[model samples]
Structure formats: C-alpha cells, structure tokens
Target: MLHVISQDLSSFNTLGLRSNASALVRYEHAGQLPALSQLAQTYKKVFVLGGGSNVVLAPDLSALVVKVESRGVRLVAESSDAWLVEAQAGENWHEFVGSCVDKGWLGLENLALIPGTVGAAPVQNIGAYGVELEQRIQSVTAWNLQECRLVEMNAEACRFSYRDSFFKHEPMGRWLITAVRFRLPKAWKAVLGYPDLRQHAILAAAGENATARQVFDAVCEIRRRKLPDPAVLGNAGSFFKNPVVSPARYEALHKAHEQLVAYPQDNGDYKLAAGWLIDQAGWKGRRMGPVGVHDRQALVLVNHGGATAQDIAQLAQTIRVDVAARFDVVLEQEPVAIA
Candidate 1:
C-alpha cells in the first residue's frame, strides 16, 4: 500500500484535466487490502480509480482517491481447449490482451489496444468490434465495502449490460473489483460481431485461415485508424455508448429517417449508432473555443489543446442537445464525471 498526499491527477488521467486530490492511495497488492480497508473507513469519502480512461475529473475533489493498482495473472484451471485465468486489477488491459495473444487464448485479441485495467473491463462491460469483455468473463473478485470482506461473483451475477455491470448499478460503490477471471478457449471461434470487422476479416482472408494473432493485429490496426489516440489529441473513444431501444421505436425512426443506422439486439431491441446520428447532426470536425468534435468520429469530443474539462463538457452537451432535438433520442455519456 502506497499513500501519498497532494498527488497530481492530470498526468494519471488520460484527459489531462487538472483535478487535485486531498490524498491518494495506491493499492498494488491483494495482501494490502486490510490496510486499505482500514484507511477507507478512516476517510470520510472514498473514490476508486482504475485506468483513468473513462472519467472526467472536477476541478475540486472532495474525497480520498484510492488508485487500485493490484497486478498479476494466474492460470487456475486448464483443459484441452480452455483455461480459467485470473488477472489482478492493475494489469494493463492491452498488455494482458497481448499476453493472451501470445498464449493463443482467442477471446481478447479483438479487444486489443483498449485502455484501462482488467478490473475496469467489466464495470463498463467494455465492448468493441462486436465483442464485449462480459462474454469472456468467468467471474469477478471484489471487495465488498459494506461487508468489509472479499467476495466473488459469477458472470451472470455481474448482471452484464452494454457499458454497465452490477457494480455500476445496485448499491453503487458497494464493492471494489480486485481481480477478474476469464475462461478463454485455446482454440475457438473468432466472432466478427460488427459488420465492419467482418468485412475487414474477409478482406484479410480471416475466415478459417486467420489466427488469433492476425485478428488482433487487424483489429488493432482498424481501431488505430478509426479512433484518435488520446495521448496525441485529447478525446475518449466513443464518448457515448450506442443506445439500445425497442425494435418498434427503431423501426419508427428508420421509416421516418431512412439514413438512420441501427443494429438489432438479440432481445428484440435495437442498438442505434450514436456516431451516425452525431455526424448527421453536423458536429464532425466542428470547433468551438478549444474543444471540438473529432473529424473522423463525431461521437468523440476532442480537446484541441488548452481545452478545460468544462469546455469539453460544454461541447459534448451541445452535440447531445442537437442530436436530441433532431431525433427523439436522448444521448448519454460513457465517461464518468466526478464533480
């Protein structure tokens, strides 16, 4: 357990927003749980931080920030075709995906280059290229804050949804995910859930001939081209999730607006493409002050240098309001803002 005071959060958070914490604690090991718990109890308000990817910090922080940094990987079970692997929270998600690629574990390769820690994967139910982390998750090990005990929850119990989980819903802030277990196949089907990936795979001859490594490389290349790196220009990948609505509502919109793009969900719902709507709303590459909508991906709001958190928020709100006015759909942000 590492405790530090007056730590700067700008560098830690990818957005580079200058939010100062009164105190910050780094929990890098599972064994340090007891000490961290005791410290949490001592503090009035506690906030947990992981990859610093999907968050926008307020200018002033009112709680003690605990950075969950636990790190490791364990292969607990194995069979001829699959393995039950556990990874500590601090393990960089992309690095872990690379490791799985090296081992020929097939589930995570398409999600390569996704930022944040393993523990955060389930929280957002992080999805890309037709694959979500929840589909690969076996279970999650978390610290129950109210009970002050460590507990394990199976995949079903996690109540996975698009960019959501049990931790994000019921009894919010009730637990801190410590480690996540994933059961991946050594030899498996590489699902091209998204049409774009499917076409890309076909172009690369990614049918039965493509290996997991090729798929990972191809997906990473695709993402690199589609999404701007926040390290270079400030922006979160897809600031808002694709909105899921009833099939009837989707069809209604489709009939009215023939250009609207949507994907049918398994449960008879339809996932509306937020990007297509935002781009149609004429926000792409539009600049205001220091913030602007990314030219390539309108769903992403960019901070084109000297942009403050408020400026980004304002621009995003404008886009949301415009989209909402044009279509009857209300936009929701994917990033968690702590004010």
Candidate 2:
C-alpha cells in the first residue's frame, strides 16, 4: 500500500479548497480493502475520496484518506430485454456513460457529463434530465469496513431516494463502494421530459425522433453552458437540491409567488426549482468574499480562488437563510462537507 504523510488534497476536490490529509492511502485493487479496513481502525477519522466532485473539504483533515482508483468495465450478464454491465468504482462517470452510449447501452445518456466516479454515483443517487441513477442500477458491490468483507446490494436494498441513498446515511468509512452494476434496457426510450432538456434548442431541433446520442450530446452541451468547469473555476455543479414540498405547501407557495418554477411528482408532492428561489432571493451573480454564486446558474456556488471550506459553508448558510426568509422554504445543500 502506498502511503503519503500530510498529503495535499487541493486538487482532489472539485471545489479546490486547500485541504490536507494526515495520511493518504492509494486503493487500486480489492486486495487493499483489508489494509484499508485496518487503517480505518487505526485512525480516529477516515474519509473515502472518489472523484471528489461532490465534496467540500476543510483546511486540514486529521484523518486517513483512502483514494479509490480501481478501474474496469465489462458485460456481466445479458438478456433479450437488457444487458447487465459492471464498472469498477474508479472509472470516470462521464466517460463510462459515453462508452455505454457508444456501445448502444441505452439508459445513462441522460446523465452524461456528470462529474464523479462510478462508486460515488449511487451514493448521491445522481440524477439529471428526468432520470436518476437508481433507474439504471442493478446492484452495488461494496466493502463493509465494520465486517471487513465484500457485499453486494440490490436496488431495493440500496434504498434510493432523490439525490440520496443508504450509503449517504451510513457511518463515515463504513462502506466503500468498489463497483456498480447497471441494467441497461434494450428497448430504449428518450427521456426529455425535463423542462430544460425539452426546451433545449438542440433537442428541439432533433424533434420527436431524437436518438440516444443526441440526448447525450444535448445534456453535455447544456451542462457545459450552465455549469462552470472545476478546472478553470471550481464548482460542484448544483450546490443545492431542488426542495420537495407537500402538495398543500406547493399550492400555498404558488399562490404567493405566481412565477414559481416547480414540477409535479408521482407521489403528489412538488419539487420546487431551487435555482429560481435563489435567484428570486437575490443571490445570483452575488459574491461573499472568495466564493460566490455562479452568475449564469443560480444553483451553482463557485470558488473564485483561495476559498476555504468554511467560506463555502458560510455562503451556503447565508443563502439558505435568505431563501428561507423570503420564500418560507428551506434549501438543502447537496455537497457533503468533510471536516
């Protein structure tokens, strides 16, 4: 096992917050799980770092950081209706989706260009363009640190909800996902029900006869245009989740604000557009010291430069408070803050 003391993690996270791990361990194979478990036992705190797209890191971590880097993809099973494909946790999510689309494995196209690794997808229940990762997931293989063994969990066992899953609720370093299996349907259908996707010029041009590739390209283009590139300007895509409200609450909010942007859920609840709320709350293009809300997309919070995790947290809290005061709705941040 390769270990580095006092490792800098500024480049590991998408937010680019200057942080350091007391010790960093490179996890490239399944054989390392046992050692990782031992190390986790040794350290009072331990963090499993994937692609680092959905995290806000503190200035210093007094913990052992395990960097998941296992990689591979293969068709594990096949049937007339669907194909079961397995991908190692370390694979870049966007590239994996692109490969599936290229091979005509149709389901992940709507989620193209999402930043992160395969392992982290299910944890966040990553979703976009009217579809969530749970819809495509067959099973998740993870190392259970407490038991010190590998285990496979089905979709139902995963307990997937909007932008959340069982993994998120588990104790830190308790479960480290190593691979994910996806069930891609052979009978594919376009999911352009999302307003942004449905109204996109590219998709509109494609019309009713839109192919999987077009949908993939459209999502990529839309994300590229709206989201800031973490490489150039650090950001963790949408900083806040679209708040889901009860039907009665939705009706009340809608009555008060005529221009409320929301979508109806099958469960009769309504998912309010957090971006619209933030914009209406007067936070778009606004800054707080080194961090600020992305001007183009109100949902995103960007790190201008030299911003710390505390800076991001303070700004997020300020926005949450302001939005709550104005709209009487609580906005929840999506990114996990690691101290």
Please name the candidate that would achieve the greatest lDDT relative to the true structure. 2
For model 2, how big is the CA root-mean-square deviation? Answer: 1.0
The estimated TM-scores of all candidates read 0.95, 0.98
Q: Give the alpha-carbon lDDT of every model.
A: 0.83, 0.93
Best by TM-score: 2
Question: Which regions of candidate 1 fall more than 4 Å away from where they truly are?
Answer: 170-173, 201-203
lDDT of 1 at 33: 77
**lDDT of each residue in 105-208, candidate 1, tens digit only:** 66888889998889888998998887888888999999976568999999999999889888887544557899999999777877766777767844347575
Clashes of each: 0, 0
Off by more than 4 A, model 2: 2-4
